[model samples]
Structure formats: C-alpha cells, structure tokens
Target: MMDFDVELIRRYAAENKIKFGRASSKAVIGKVIASMPEYKTRVRELIPVIERVVEEINSMSIEDLKRYYSPPVKKKVKEEFRLPPLPKAVEGMVSTRFAPNPDFVLHLGSLRPLILSYEYAKMYNGKFYIRFEDTDPKTKRPEPRFYEAIKRDVEWLGIKPDKYIYQSDRLELYYDVARTLIDRGYAYVCLCERDVFKKYVYNGLACPHRGQSIEDNHELFDKMLNRFFNEGEAVLRIKTDLNHPNPSVRDWPALRIIDTETYRHPRVYDEYIVWPLYNFSCAIDDYMMGITHVLRGAEHRVNEVKQSYIFRYMGWDPPEYIHHGRVAIPEGVLSKSKILKGIREGLYTGIDDPRLATLPALRRRGFHPKALYNVILKTGLSSSNTTIDFSMLAAENRKVIDREANRYYGVRNPKTVYIYLMDDVEVKIRVHPDHPERGYRIFRLYRGENYIYIDFEDEKYLEYGDLIMLISLGNFRVGEETLEFINNDV
Candidate 1:
C-alpha cells in the first residue's frame, strides 16, 4: 500500500513527460521540492513513498497513463434540469397518481414516486392524484388516521393532488369490473383448496372449476359477495397463460373472500367481506380515474401483467407503465410490517420516531421539504437501484437552510480566563455573515468583570505567549493567568 495518493504519482508522471519511468527518484523529489512548499519539511519521510509510486507507475498501461493525464471531457449540460419529456404525454391532458397503502406514515424513500408523479403532472399542466391502495385490510391493513396523515405529509411537501381516493370506498366499482371480466370469459371463480390449486397450477394445468360456465361463476361470485364463501374458500382468478414461464403469473387471483369479522378494516370495518386484491382494485381504478402514466418501482412490473389482462377483458387500454428501480437506505425500516412490529413491541415511539426516516421525523428535525425535492430531482428515473447516503441529504439541507438561518456562537465547555482591561469593550457582530444588510447584534464586555470565557476546545490552540486576534475588537496575548492586552487594533 502506498502512503500517499496514487493519483499524485500518476499525475506527476504524466506532467513531467516521463510515462516510461526514465526519470530518477532524485529528479521527482527535486521537482516536488520546487513546486510544493511543505515538501521542505517532510522531504525525508516522503522520499521513499514517492520512489515506490514512481516504480509502480512505470508498468502502468499507456491508456491508463493518458487517462491520468487527460480525463474525459464531460458535456456541459444545463444544471437546471428539464427532465426528458415523458413518452405519450399530452399537453394539458397528462395525468399521474401515487398509490400508497395507508398503513405506515410516508418515509423518505416514498418521496421518489411521489415527486416523479407530481412533477410529471405539473410539467404538462395536467392532473395529479393520490390513490390509497387500502384493499388488503387483513394482511396489510390501512388505518383511518393514516389516510389523512398521508395527505398531510404530501401537502407539507407542497404537492396538492387533484384528487384523493380510497380503494375500500370503491368496492362497488371493482365489483362492476369483475363482472365485466367474467362476462368476457377472462376470469373465473376457483373453489379448489390452496394445496389442490397449487398442484394443478404448478403442473401447468387448470383445476376442475376453471372451466365452470360463465353463468355458474357469476352465481358463485355473488355468493362470495353475500358472505357465502369463507376465507380461502373461493377466489376470483384472472385467466392468463397457464403455461407461462412465470408460475406466479399463471391465473393469478384477483379478489378473495376476506372475513372482515376477524380482521376489520379501519375505514370500512366489516362493511365489505369480499374485497378486490391489489392488481384487481388498482387496474380498475387506473383506467376508471383516467390515469395516463403509472410511475412506480420496478418490483411492481409483474402486477402490470395481471392488471393488463383485466383492462383487455374490459376492452380498455392500459395506462403507460414506467417502472424505476427501488430506493434504499442503510439500516432504514421501510416495511410497514417491521415498523408496525417495532411500534407494537415498544421498540419505537411511533411512526414518527426521530431515529427512523419518516416524513414527520425529518420535518421535526428541521429538514426543508425542498431538500427532499432536490434529492429526487438528482436521482431522476434511473433503472438501477439507489442507496442514499444521508450526508448528501444533509448537504442539500444546508444549502436550503443556510441562507436564512441566523448565526450563533455555541460552546460545549466555557473556560474563564482573567483579563486586565481599563475600559469596557463593545463590538457589533453581524447576525448573518452573508447578509450584512439584515442587522447586527451589539456585544459588550465589561471591564469590571476582569474575565472572559473561552471555549475549552480552543484552549489547545493557545501557547504560553501567543496572541489571539479578536476580530473587530483587538489583539490580546495569552499570559500565565491573565490575558495581556496587546493593542486596540481591529
């Protein structure tokens, strides 16, 4: 391992016209001594390290040598990003929506899809909406409070959706689409047991009930809606290619009999028993709500396939699908199940635990909304996965908040040092270093006090007889016990 930066040697080799290592170590040392000021003191220690780097550079490829010499010229793109015009976008007619389950509060990672959808809508002077995917009331249930909490967070981020929808409230609409799908022979009610269905499906074969008459399936479906079928007793399956390579996609389930008595929904408690599944409710809503483009994570790519079948069965066109990669953070808890577990187990205070990356936590910690907005704009629509380093967010926050935040002097440990002065000292300190026109605060040091507090950490920089320059006040020397007033030099 080299003690010094390897780039230094490569750059030095390239700059000196000595790519083949014909130059001697002494020559490199002499050149460093001439160019660098501190080499005069550390020349003895850095000699051998520099010599080793020179030897290593001798065998580097010609292309690598040139790479160090001349880096690729980056195209001068405009810093203000006008994101590439979305495909199939219509002026004043584009529409986008962010469909999130109202289980957990919105977290930092949720900002991507929200920002993309909202910004794309605003870009075309179109409509943006938020659809609450609250259909899975038993497994991934929604809370009455979260429906409003989600809206509050979005509004806090300056996103005003054109509409807000709850899937549970639209059960009747989903039932209508299911009926249409059944009439077209694109869906069927399956009564086979879980294991029996898996056996038939895994073998690329249909169960006995898959070929039931359309009229018969309708009767069974009505029974399910009327609470006739118990949980797992029957499910509506959208008929797809049973021989398809993806086993999960083979005649996937659309709606199931959810026993609301056992696990009640917060919004529609025991109101609807047979509820639509994710793909079913989402597909129905997308086409019905006039969604022009669907911007979501790439993991939902298979859901598009299931939803497309429903749209086709109804003779409707599916919305444009844009699936980007997932966004992750180090040790972040984005899973609602894990977060809910933590809260129930008393490990976390709530969804707004300052330790977590929830929107409320970041807001309480004073992170500006534009900081999160800039982060999303920087990431854009890359298909590759994103792992955010929070320091980048902090840097962005500093940029957003630094201009308006007033300056203040804070010290951990204050050390009182005796000061001998004949008169009081008054100084005007700027409230903000960048904006002097804002105002100034008057600081007065009384002479009768005979002492001033210095930061404990700054004491290490003092010597027996060193002078400390107090800006706009004067210079004073550090005495054995007292601070010697040097001069009234501002």
Candidate 2:
C-alpha cells in the first residue's frame, strides 16, 4: 500500500508537470514518509474534501505546460434549441381559402366540406381564408340578413376564417385574366346562341370559333359585346382541347354577359360586358392567393382537371388537389333552392329548422361540437359516398349531454294523496339518487293533512290500508279515496 501510494503520487506529479523541490533520491525518502498507512488513509479520505484549498495553494497555472502535459478544459457553452427547417415551398407557409357562394344559407353539404378544408389547413399549419363567391348577380339575393345568418352559423360551429375575401371586390382582376386569354388566342368570343353553345359545349364537340384568330374573332366579339352591352347579345368561350374525352372539356364558356339589376357594378356595366366563369375565376384566385393545396368535394373532381388546364394554359402551376365525398340528403329533404322556396311559402321555418341538418339546428338540439367533429372523423377522409344513419349521430349526442344535463321530475297527470304522519315529521327527497353530493330537497308532513299531489296511476294500484312508498321518503298508509284525493291516516 505504501509503495503503491508513492508510485501514484509520483506519476500524477510527473503527468501534471509539477516540479518537486527535492532531488529524486531525497524525494523518494520523503514520499516513503508521506505514504505510511496512517498518513495515506488520512490524505486519501480528506484530500477530496480540501481540493479547493490545495488548488489555491498550488496556484495551478497551466498556460506554460498546457501543450506538454495538461490539456485545456473545453468549455461547453449552452445553446438554444431550434426546430428543423421547413421546405422552401412551404417556408412562408401555404394558404387555403374556402369560397362559398352566399346565394343561400349553407346546408350540411357545404358545412361538411368547409369543416374538412378548415381541418386540413390546420393540420398543415397553414392559413385559411373564407371568400364569399358572390359573383353571379342573377343568383345573388340582395339580402344582408341571410349573409349575417350564415356567418353566425359558421362561428357557432367554431370555424372562423383567418381572413375574409369577397369575389365582388375582384371583378376587375377576373376581367383582366379574360382579356389576357383572348389576346393569347386561348379564348374567343362566341357568336353562337345559348342552345347552340350548350349542344357543342356539353357534347365535347368543336365550335366554328376554334380555328379563328383573335384578330378576326375580336371583330365579331366587339359586335357581340356592343350588342350585348347596348342591345343584349352573345358570350365568350375558352378554346380548350376539343378531343378531350370529358364532355366538360370542349370549348367551355370563359365569360358571358348577364343583364341583371342585382350586379353591384351596375354603373360599370357598360365598361365591361363580359363576365368570367366559375372555373376561370377559381383558377385565377387560387394562383393569386398562393394556395398549395385545394381540398374540395368530389363533385368538383372533373372541374379540378378543367381548372388544371386553365392553369397550364396561363403558365401557372396548379395547386395540389384532393376531392372528398359530398354529403347527400335523404329523398324527402328538399334541395337548397326548393328549401328556400318552402321557407318563403311557409312550408317550414327559416334555414335552421330542426328538421334540416343546418349547424344551428344541430346546436339547438343539444349536439356538442365534439360530437360533430367525431362524426366527420368517423366518416374518414375518402371520396366514397357514404350515408350515415341519423340515429347514430343522435346516440353520440345523448352520450355527451347525459353527463351534464340536470334532472327534474314532472307528472303528466296527477291525483291528490292525503298523508297522516306524527305532527311535525319531516320528509326529504333527493333530486338525483346517484348524485347525492348534489344535496336533498325537504317536504314537511303534518298530522292529518287533507290532501297532497300524487300520480293518478299510483292511486289505481293502492287499496285501503295499503302502505305506499314515496321514492325518497318513508311509506304512508292509504285510509280512503274520494273523487279529488287519496286519504292516508297512519
């Protein structure tokens, strides 16, 4: 042990470049004295406790010897944690917009898609905007009350958009896009009447305007536009691939002039006669808003391809697309337009009628937002059409409401009961049996009381001198029965 301690101290001193004052032979004798069992035990156990004192005495300067013996202590500075970088395409984050035409109140079909789009945007941590696509003046009813009601219903369902956009504010932009397409020879003004246009358009057949140059077509377009504005005439059609298999693909109308007083720009009606179609407007808006993902109902699946063609023609990258299934109503439920007619004709109340699947009606019937979310989640994010049982939704609602709703007892029909208890005896009845923590309600019982209220059904089963139990109170004996009351005198 003595020899081992001396060797350890000598090695540490050498490694640390510490110079002992004594020569090697004298140092060995001094080390022998210092490494005795008693001395070794004292130093080994106590040195760690006095390390700071030893460091101070030694004045440990490693600057000169660092390279030779002592290595520098590498200081570890604390660093702030950072998340991994996002893709460049989404670094600024993508934006999604839910554009609902405010021509009528939003029904279950609309709400289903809105919820889906909103949730999908949130999942990707993107911004969501709500745009009122009130472009068609003919369809746009001049009613602020309907708009206010729709907004209120959306808010009640907890879906508030980060930004609100209106198509009516961007009519000029749509016109500009239409003009660009016409100048680029991708669109031409059609002289054909509505029926002729529909036959060629719906059948995917080529129109006579397909081979005409914009210079040649513009003259005819101007004549049509002038007559349409001043005399009321024809429309402009987009020149797409006529050979495309989908009937919706052939020479589709990009613009049309509608003579309606409902146009917000009635004064500018003469300045621009042509109006952009739904697909054109959608393509322009999506590109301008920098939307990366377009989530919509499957009914618009074919429209997605049409919009993609428009984007391709304009040299813009179309947004990523996902089309979900539409919510179908049962046969008896009227179409939205018919429902509006019914409301106007006093067939039903306003849009939130309980029989309808509007958000307000579901809320009024005590359905929780969680239950609605659950229904959507259970439905899954697929394009397959599914009809969910209404009773299934109702059962889910009852589970949530049952825990929080207060209980009360009311008899539909009643008869009088007379009770005779000892004078000043008290009876206590609890409002809820399983919930005793809610406390109890008291009833006073007086001796020879003439009459009290009981259910009429309770009287038919009771006989003379029969003891009947009150739900939460002691039993009483029935003494007699009259037309008005059951007399108990026990």
Candidate 3:
C-alpha cells in the first residue's frame, strides 16, 4: 500500500460531499484532479500521499465522522471487477454525439443538446460527431438546404463535430444487428394490424401470440410477409419481460411495416417491408459509433433507459447518460412546423423571419455567437425543464454589440421642422456626437429659414417657441411645429 495523508483526504472528501452530493464526492474529486493534465502524470507518485490520507481517515471515530463523511448507500452489484493498474498516458475518455433527425431544421431545443455535447467534448479533449438520425423514410423529408443551414449555424456558434454520420447510410448495419437479435431469440415478428397492435402493446394487454416461439411464428410471419409486408404486414418486437413494471420494458416494437405509398427509401430502389424502430436503430448506432457519453434532452430519458436494455441484451457497454432539459418557446410562438406552414402560405418571408429564433434571424438582429454561447453557459445543464425569456437573450446580445459597435445617426421616420436663422451660415455637424474625432460635415443653412428635418416624436416635446438644441450646435428657438423645410437644397 502507498503512504497517504488520511486526514487531508477526509477533509477534502468532506468538503466535496458538501459541495456535490455525498455519493458524488469521490467521482467529483477524481474528475477535478484528472482535469489537471500536470497532476494526472504524477498520480503514481501521489499514491503514497493518498494512502496516508486514507489511513488517517480510518482512525477517526465512525460516529464522529458520520457527520462529516456520509458513506453512500450501497447499490446492488450487477458485476464485479478489480481496479485496473493506472495507465502511463492519460487517455481522453469522453465521446459525445449530436443526433438530430433531419425531418426539421434545428431549433433552440436542439441547440441546447448540441452545445452541451460540444462543451463536454472540448472540456475532455474528446471526439464529438454530428450524426443525422435520418431514419423513418415515411416521415423523413430530406431538405439539403436544412442540412446546409444547420452546418452554418453550428460553425457560426464555434462548434465543430469531429465527423458527420448519416443513419440512412447505416441501414445495412442496423439490419445486421436486427438479424443477430432475431437469431438469438431476443426478438420476434408480430403480424398484427398497426392500430390493434398499438392498442394492445401500449395498454399492456396480453396478445394471443405473446408467448409463441419465433419458430412457430415463422410460417405465420412468412404468410403475413408475403400477403401484407411484401405487397404493401408485420412488425418486429423485442421479447422483453411482460411483467416488468415499466411499460417500456414490455416487448416493444423493434421494426414496423410501412405502406408503399407512405415510404420512400433514399438508397433502396424497391419498396421494403420492414423498418427498424427508433429505439432499435438508435441503440445500435450509438454502440457502434463508440459514443461514451449520451447527452440529450430529458424528454429522451425514458428512451435512454430502453436503449440501455438493448445494449445490455447485446452484451455491449452502455454509455453514460446525461439528460438536459428541453427548450420551450413562449406560448403562442410558432413552432418550426407552423413556421414552415407560414412560409408556404406566404404568411412569413422565410425561415429567417426576425420573429423566429432561427440562427439567420439572430444573426440579422446583430446577435453575436459569443453572446449566444454565454447564454448557454449561464443556463448550464439541468435535467428539469426550463424556459428562457427571449428578452434575456436580447439583453445579453446588446451588451456584446454595445461594446464593439460605433453609434451612427439614422434619421428614420423623419419629418420637416422649421428654425428661424438670423443670417445665412454654414454649420459643421459631427456625424456622431460621442465620436467627435470622426470629423464634421458641413450643412448649409438658409437665412430667414424657419424649418429643418427632425423626427415627428422630437416635435412633440418642443413648444411653439421653446429653445431646442441640435446635437453639438448652439441652441435654436423653435418657430413652430411646421412640416416645411426651407428649399430642398438646405
């Protein structure tokens, strides 16, 4: 055993427990220490220090230490293994992915997950892949422009995925795994009608074919395949325990038959009968892609658990799951679908309409990518749902722009006002009051002229004969709230 400082470890561990949850102290400390590249290399030399610390901690009274060091509750051990020897080189472990279905353009909700994945990948020096989960040809509408838009948005936000993978390209891989599962007696074909199948399975009601062997169902499946599936019949399902409390654990559909009219595969020339379900395809892809960290919205938390079972059944290592909240727009705000509808109906100009939260709209509104990044940092990662005020984002944007942008005078909504001049003179006016170094421009004035151009709102504050100031120039008495300017030349 290496010599370690037991007392120091106890103090550090107690402080960590107070900071993080009691159960998270060790992991938190380990993570913190591992993050320091310099310290990671000296871990072997530091083992003695850790041993001494543990020894001192062991000497403390169990009852007294209970107040400081709350041991975590023991969990049921599903597997057992001895700790491996520390490696010579510190390996970057985190691998995250942004899996977006190509059905719609990326939204604020999707941006949150991408940001989390990107940040984690950067923090751990890990690889992050942008995977297009473009399954379900029935619902998939491949818009090349949408993919281009997403790429531009991600790049603008300073996020770069290590590689781009498409689920459509991996259909053969999914089919191979599906066949493996079927061969292993882990999945079975169900030849039930769509509506009837959903009603029975979702309600947890037993079907007559529930416990039928795959071999026994093969002939029936063939008949159904020929009559319904090939022509236009059957769905495939995983044979999980029906008594499992979670409805998701009950034999869930792994594949479904699609109508020829509704389906259009990108690569497949002929109409296909079977299609991998969401959970099945996602689990297989994540495992194959070596995704170590699965960071996604909390809405998919249940789906992650189901995927975990799929991984377990296949004897594959399940990735760490981090569920973050979904981003919800204010009520009555248009959804992406509604926005698309608006575009189609000519209700709005395009996807970049200023009212929507699309990246192009944000860019046009003068919002910097750094400001959007700061918003994500401030929001952090939470499993609970959170709503962000649009104004809050606007405020952050203003701070960034105000620091770098120079003020310019723009006479929008201008109206003619009159000011009496005793003599004809040329006045020099600075283009910007605060930026006097930018120099001045000459404006010719007319003798006996009583009017100049000003915004209509400015006229309201001026009394008929009240003194008004033209920025940086001598004050002038307002003759009257007149719309006439002294000749177009002046």
- Best by lDDT, which number? 1
Q: Look at candidate 2 and tell me the lDDT of residue 394.
A: 68
Question: Which residues of candidate 2, in runs, are more than 4 Å off?
Answer: 1-94, 140-142, 199-205, 216-232, 262-273, 331-334, 360-370, 419-490
TM-score against truth, every candidate: 0.82, 0.67, 0.66
Ranking under lDDT, best-scoring first?
A: 1, 3, 2
Q: What does candidate 1's lDDT look like per residue over 82-186, in tens digits?
A: 677888999999999999888778998899999999999999999999999999888887887888899999999999999888888899998888898889898
Candidate 1, residue 270: lDDT: 95
lDDT of 3 by residue, 1-490 (tens): 3333444456665544333212123343464354343455567766556545444543444355567665567564432222221212124777788987666666656667788777777777778999877667676655566667778888999898999887777766776776677667777777667677667767777666666776755554555445545522566677776666777667887766655355565545234555677899889988888888777788787787667768878999888776777777673234777888989998878877777777776677677987777777666676677776566677677756655565656756688766666567677766554567877777676666555566664545555544334643345555544422222221
Q: Report the number of the highest-TM-score candidate.
A: 1
Return the TM-score for candidate 1, rounded to 2 decimals. Answer: 0.82
Please, what's the RMSD in Å of model 3?
Answer: 20.7
The parts of candidate 3 lying over 4 Å away from their true place are: 1-91, 198-228, 246-248, 259-262, 267-273, 331-336, 344-346, 360-366, 413-452, 460-469, 474-490
Error of 1 at 62 (Å): 44
| Pairs of residues clashing in candidate 2 | 227-232, 228-233
Give the alpha-carbon lDDT of every model.
0.81, 0.62, 0.65
Superior by lDDT: candidate 2 or candidate 3: 3
Over the stretch 333-446, how does candidate 2's per-residue lDDT look in tens digits? 536777778789998697767777766666766677766765765665567886654555765576555555556767657876666555555656555555667777777655
**Tell me, what's the RMSD of every candidate?**
10.2, 28.0, 20.7
1 against 3, candidate with superior lDDT: 1
Q: Candidate 2: lDDT of 34?
A: 46
